[model samples]
Target: MRALSPPVGLPMLAESDLVRQVARRLSDAIVQGRLAPGAKVAEAAVARELGISRAPVREAARLLESQGLLRACPRRGFFVRALSAADVDELYDLRLCVERHAAVAASRRLTAEARAALRRQLGLMRELAHRDDPARIVEADYQFHRLICETAGNSRLLRLFDGLASELRLVIGLIGRLYDDPHEIARTHEPVLEAIEAGRPERIVAHVDHHIGVAWREVARLARTLSPTPGGAA
Candidate 1:
């Protein structure tokens, strides 16, 4: 099992604040592959390392479990969630449904500020792709989608998208190696922005569907590679 690193010098904040901070740090570590999937997340170990109490660490693990980033078992505590092909399919399907609606809503009336924000995110994504940091690239990619969700102006829709943030970052982390060319990553997102700029809802939806469809395929491939071999029963 990979070791869970404590956040540097945690402040003596409120219980909820401590839990949230611990959750965020743990989530980032998991997304960055610092915490391997299926590895046990011992609250005692984490709490000890952070110089905090186990209560907050336990609460943080529960929060991560709710985000689909961790799994909790009876008497087994928490472990990083091991994703499967089916999980990938389901996630992408949900994203397709939500994002298609968001794209349409965003395209209905692309305000000047929204357009500028979208363009800025796109440019940042392109720039980040050129860098050697996969995490930054993934974040920039997320920003692009988030910009569209914000433009949609539907609070519920935005919340739905926000809820998927952790899983999406984990997926990108898992498949970062599959993206051999950073420029290609940037290129895949270009059509979505162009469609939005065209102010065509159907076109935007089509572009989003295609983008997510490609990602689904990549995730499926990774899943198959990670699956157990035949006759290798547990």
Candidate 2:
């Protein structure tokens, strides 16, 4: 039987941090492909590996279930959620809508502090890409877009973006190195930031649409490759 692989060099969790730490470790496993689609997440094995009790592991799985990373079964326990091409398509569709509007809003409301924050995030993405760390790069990529949503000055829009966070992370991880150079991923966002900085609503909308639309098409295509059957989860 395949065993759960504990994340290397992680310290033992303290009492207060058990559930969140377990959930984060499990989430890292899922996003990094250590836990594959539809694979059973054995609570016992995970607890053993993490040197924790079954209770925290169970609670962590439930948390991940709410995040759409795992689905619960009555007797069989939790399994990693399998995403279909349709799932990817739908997810990006929502992102395109949310981000396009958010970018337009951000362009109008661009503050000096917000601009610096976005630039800092972009720099971080470039550095992470240079180190060839895809997982962290994916995270930085999300933060770049998330910053746009936050700068939009709409609490509800930011909330909408937050809701899609985990599933977006999962799908991007599954897509795995969307660009060959990894630096290309960072490069693609340059125009979006430029458009925002320019404070042109039409330019912001166009760039945002193109950026997300490109990813949407690529992710959908790759998802279909990963799971061949029409609308079938894998």
Candidate 3:
């Protein structure tokens, strides 16, 4: 059982908050691969389809633009930003640093209640698997990792990875990989979780670092495939 972090609260939105609502919807779509890599975004069409004005949609596009999810084109609309090998490497490297430390710190604080909470998340993921819904599987995996981060008791670490997680979703999709392959991810995680629950901090770190290696290679592969040869970055 590990100590998991409590759920984060939503920040207060202004009285007039259409822009944020639009932004959040688009962000969720992008993260889930509903708006996948290299897809063109028609602002007017998205606005029409979503039944909102273009102003909010445009603002939403811009929000993702700064986050490296969308790229603006002159005299054209936005397109999903492709990840370069360098970009993927950088993203995963940061993930490794943050997750490694978080895993170690969290392992030291494992509690019985936390273990049950994680098992619940895993069961939910298994249930989502019955439908073969990749997106749901990915979302569940995100929550599962969030559970690990929560146990680390580091707010800043979770916040840092939160941003990375969205882009990482795109990376996973690019590789035609789901965030959690039930058996594979389970194998990788079970060892770490077991080690953590058993209070073997050293073995816990070993299992975690080993599991992260797969992600590192996947990102490296994606970075190379997304390089300037096909279509350069925007």
lDDT of each: 0.82, 0.84, 0.71
- TM-score-based ranking, best first? 2, 1, 3
TM-score for each prediction?
Answer: 0.84, 0.88, 0.80
Q: Model 1, poorest ten-residue lDDT window?
A: 225-234
Reference-based TM-score, model 2: 0.88
**lDDT score, candidate 1:** 0.82
- Cα lDDT for residue 232, candidate 1: 22
Instruction: Kindly list the per-residue Cα lDDT of model 1 for residues 1-234, writing each as its tens digit.
Output: 999986655454567798999998898778777787677788998999899999999999999989888888777678888787888888889988999999889988689889899888888877877776777877787878888999999999999999999898888777666788877777888899899889887788889989988888988788667643222211
Worst lDDT 10-window in candidate 3: 225-234
Q: Which stretches of candidate 1 lie over 4 Å from their true place?
A: 1-13, 227-234
RMSD score of candidate 3 (Å): 8.4
Q: Which stretches of candidate 2 lie over 4 Å from their true place?
A: 1-16, 228-234
**Where does the lowest 10-residue lDDT sum fall in candidate 2?**
225-234
Residue 136, model 3: Cα distance from true site in angstroms:
1.6
* Candidate 2 structure quality by residue, lDDT tens digits, 1-234: 999886554344554378888998988888887887777889999999988789889988999999998888778788888777788888988888899899999988999999999999999989998898877987888888899999999999999999999998897786554667888888899999999999898998899888888878887777666532222134
